[model samples]
Target: MTTLTLRGLRTASRFQRVQPHPLLGLQSQFLVPQTPSFRYASTTSALPTRTPRTFPVNGPSTTLPAPLNVPARGENQSLVPYLYSVGKSYLAFYKTGVWNIYTNFKLSREVQRKIDAQNASTFSAAVVSASLTRSDLQLLVRNWHDIKRVPMFALVLLICGEFTPLVVIAISSIVPWTCRIPKQVESDRRKLEQRRSASFRELTTEPPTEAGVEKLAKTQLMHINKSLGLSFGMWDWVGGLPTGILRRKVSRRVEYLELDDGLIRKAGGIQHMELEEVKMALVERGVDVLSKGEAQLKGHLNAWLLSREKAPVEKLLLTRPSVWPVRMNAPEKV
Candidate 1:
């Protein structure tokens, strides 16, 4: 009985310790359902995700529109609207002036000094520019006359319409830019017509070339001085402005015009500019815009610009003998 029990125990132990299948230990490496397979990947992708840049260079274009000073107009546009605009313009002008004055006065001493200097420089530039151009000079004169009449005009308004009509009657070319009536415009047209009608049938002028610029400039200086029509014949040879004075003036004028030419050309040339601007340019260059057609005016302006464009020699024109007698330094003896 003991032997049989021991044999039975050994048999049971052998059955429990049976050998395992070869695929059981390598199940992960199988491709088939019942076979072993490789392990799944645990690492992320090799390439990185892309993002946009923080800042870019180009943005947008900035071309400007031309300014248009169009007047009020319609089937029933009346004098009231025009009057309102004039009042608005006057108020704006005064408001700007007062504001500028106030701001300038509030600045520190050093800042005020700088501002004053800047203002003086600007004033000088404006004066020189105005005097060099005819239309600008006319405008300057008109404003001056307007300024002189402003006090009387204010008084008339203060009197409660008592002298308003009388003041209006007295108002002619001396009227402010903001207060010009249709009659004034008509008067200007009439003046232009009369001037055109009375002038010479044909006019000619000598233009300076690159070859003989000095002589031409001198001749031009004398001619310009003569054209100025100063009282008592100040530009005539006998009682004329000294040649030195003429030279100085002409030289400065030429330099100013030359400096402005590039800017004007780049700003689409004088030919297509505002009528007043074109007139200003032509008047300064001795071209008659009056009674001329648009094409003719443009042609003259273009010719004027072309004539001066290549002549940087004008800068040294003052160094030459002006349109007057020059005592050649007695041919200094050797």
Candidate 2:
């Protein structure tokens, strides 16, 4: 019986050990269903956070921004002494009648002394003289006839008449009329008629170039001898256009000019042109000769004439072709 009990106990222990191994194998199979074949990896590295620079709550920083490098106003350089001398001379001419009164003022010694004295930073004489000259407002008024061609009231009245005709008539009835000579009135009337009738005839009888000179000469009310002079002897010509109507008439004639110095016999013996024609030809040729790609040739021509420096017509054409037409409409300031 003792032997049987020992064998039974050995068998039970063996069975228990085998049973635990089978259960452990089953547990591992169940756990295998929960496990993943591929592990996930993070794509991005961790980034560090930064603190922004902050200003003090009390006040702004003493150091200026990069752009604020200009000098203070009081630190600027002083004006030149010769400039001050010029100012003194201009002041003397304008004020005190000193320039005219002191005839000896032009002498070198007196002039130099005044100029030197005037140049000082706090020159008392200059300051006093300038202040006094500026303050003396009475000297500013002058005789209108001495310098101005027409009275200020006449110009004002003319403008006023155009703008307010009723006011002009009312004022005219109150003021006494100044009588001008009938001959003078007739002369002015003839001049006005000539200006209004200054139309460009197609010159069926003669070319505009030829007819323009004769017409311009005959149209002049003031008789000027052709043999004695190259230019017309009109005082109005020297003084330039007197009225807007006259100016427009002159501009219209100038626009149609196409003649050269010689005779231009147009088709069917219609007209003949002469010297004014030649001048016109020069002006037209001047457009071709003076112009570049896109620029007005006349301005270039004038600039060349004034400065004697070459301006590029070729490069101008290449750069700006649209400005070429501007030459025709340009104002004749010269």
Each candidate's lDDT (Cα)? Answer: 0.36, 0.23
| TM-score, per-candidate, Cα-based | 0.36, 0.15
Per-residue C-alpha lDDT of model 2 across residues 1-334, encoded as one tens digit per residue? 0111111111122222332222111121111222111100111222211122111110011110011111223444455554454444322222212111111111212222342455442222332444211111101111111112123334543454323223433233221111111233234334433432332121123212222222443323111111111123353356433344343333222322211011111111112212222222223222222223222333443332222112222112111223432333221222
* Best TM-score among the predictions, by candidate number: 1
The predictions' CA RMSDs to the true structure, in order, are: 37.1, 46.4
The best candidate in terms of lDDT: 1
Error of 2 at 76 (Å): 45
- Where's the lowest-lDDT run of ten residues in candidate 2? 57-66
RMSD of 1: 37.1
The clash count of every prediction, one per candidate, is 7, 18
lDDT of 1: 0.36
Model 1, residue 160: distance off in Å is 19
